[model samples]
Target: MTLDFSVVTDVWQSLVYGTLGTLFLAVAGMIIATIIGVLGVAILRTHMVIPSFLVTAFVEVIRNTPFLVQIYFIFFALPLAGVRLNPTMTAVLALGLNGGAYAIEIIRGGVESIPKGQTEAGLALGLHNHEVFRMIVLKPALRAIYPSLSSQFILLTLTTAICTSISAYELTSVGQRIEAETFRSFETYFTLTGIYLVISMVTMWTLAAIGRRAFNYPQR
Candidate 1:
């Protein structure tokens, strides 16, 4: 019944390695999701009815489904269709797609919040449609939604723990292995909980600093 943290000392390296794996998965997924989000927004904004419909459908399907199920499908089902992927890749793809669905809506809201006159003004200035989007709209929209986007990414980082379900070898998976070895379930999980909190706080603070640098401006 005595509490012992000596087990942690023994397994600290493994836990640290696992945390780095978790960070890698989260960061890779975030990059993929951001790319997908930008593309999804572009597709949705297009005048083409079919592409817009398809993008909307993709967003709806991903947003409505449970992330675990999506991961299972990516890990379990895709291989059956001859589209095999490694556990890490599967985890990244699943997490990215899941996050992308939410990001689309977030980015779309940012885009929509800008006054229509801004778009018109950009077009009137002899800019191409893409240039107008990039120069006149995208930056401001991103600045407006940067906080929400950062929060989503933080959630994405936490969601990396679920990657362990697919044996993706993230922090939670390593913690489970350590717990199995040490039989110190309480101490192991408590430490993991604390580590996750630290990760979350660090991520938030880092994003806030990036936001200040990227989005700071004089408000009228």
Candidate 2:
């Protein structure tokens, strides 16, 4: 079998566009996931039984269910409830909700690691609830969990490929179009593998830099 890379050369522009699309989805989804995670933790800390129980239930359901099914439900079933969204929106929403579940647990562990005295100290200093959360609990917890969150974000970035099932304009959807035209199955997928690796590497580097800036702590 003659492996031809000329197929990749011909579809290079499409691939580039797809990479940009994937990056957009990944970054946007990461932002949404982070917001959900932080907010979820805040609600759980309130110790209000009903709200805490609901948040716990949301996390548990998302964590237990398959991501593919979650995406499908958001894209298809949500419309029946009048929540119509384009594939891109649906994919971003699903990715955020899915990642947020894990983020909640990761961030919660970080929070739990901190001694309760710090929180009590902050309260005694006359800090408001949100202030204590933002200043005392959240920042350090995020620092502690940064590596895990970075890994999860990278996985979320790769998961963008799955958005192709809904015709989202991401890397995999673009690759499928190119593959259909080129019929170089092995070559096409081989090229895609390389591209995905590069994207993951770049994402990892970016996350590392952000962590260094945001979570820099003196090593004891």
RMSD of each predicted structure: 1.0, 1.1
lDDT (0-100) at residue 182 of candidate 2? 80
Worst window of 10 by summed lDDT in candidate 2: 211-220
lDDT for position 13 in model 2: 94
For model 1, residues 1-220, the per-residue Cα lDDT tens digits are 8989889877789889998999999999999999998888888878689998988998999988889999999989998999999999999999899899999999999999989999999999899999988767888999999999999999999999998999998999999998998899999999999999999999899999999998788643
**Segments of candidate 1 deviating more than 4 angstroms:** none
Task: Give the distance in Å from residue 147's predicted Cα in candidate 1 to where it truly belongs.
Answer: 0.7
| Residues 119-152, model 2: lDDT tens digits | 9999999999899999888888888899999999
Clash pairs, candidate 2, are none
Count of clashes in candidate 1: 0
lDDT (CA) for every model shown? 0.91, 0.92
